[model samples]
Target: MIRAAKCSFCGGDVEPGTGIMFVKRDGTVLHFCSSKCRRSMLELKRKPVKVKWARKTREQAEAKVRRR
Candidate 1:
């Protein structure tokens, strides 16, 4: 998949003839049109996003008992 030269955050068109890249751990390549956008994305990646309700949680869970 070829990512266009656009800001991944803002989706703004990236200036042609001006871009940078880096190799990820998975051997995937990243293309950034500008330093600012790249920095923003890097910062975002550093933080762990919280996922709600991956399965069942106490907030929306119930207790059940079983007997033989």
Candidate 2:
């Protein structure tokens, strides 16, 4: 069984052969679930921390400590 890769931008599951793959000159591999994610990361230069819809953003928010 093959394991599906997660989107590098949104942290969503990326089924095999259904998403875009990108490789940087530094040998880093990136996978995106859709053109929106790819464009946001590559073209718009948006950070996942600032994207409200990204699962990664939500996870990071949930993981943060609430100091009073």
Candidate 3:
């Protein structure tokens, strides 16, 4: 079975057979669920926390850790 990837920018899931995969010169693999994520991380160089559309903020990450 194909595994789902987490978006490097928005922390969203990138389902198998969908989304974009980027490989940097240093061999770092980056996955994006949509063009918005790709552009935000690459072109616009924006942070996910600063983008409201992402909705995955630092607080959410802290909450997840607490829940776990």
List the pairs of residues colliding in candidate 2: none
Best-matching candidate per TM-score: 2
lDDT of 3 by residue, 1-68 (tens): 78999999988899999999999999999999999899989999898877777857865777889999
User: Cα miss at 25, model 3 (Å)?
Assistant: 0.6
- Please provide, for model 1 over 1-68, each residue's C-alpha lDDT reduced to its tens digit, 9 standing for 90 to 100: 55356444334565656677766899976666666556756755521122232112222333332221
TM-score of 2: 0.86
By summed lDDT, which 10 consecutive residues of candidate 2 come out lowest? 59-68
**Which runs in model 3 stand beyond 4 Å of their true positions?**
58-68
- Candidates in order have lDDT scores of 0.49, 0.93, 0.89
Deviation of model 3 at 44, angstroms = 0.5
Query: Who wins the lDDT comparison?
Result: 2
Clashes of each: 0, 0, 0
lDDT head-to-head 2 vs 3, winner: 2
lDDT of 3: 0.89
Question: What's every prediction's RMSD, in angstroms?
Answer: 11.5, 1.9, 3.3
- Checking candidate 1 for backbone clashes, the offending pairs are none
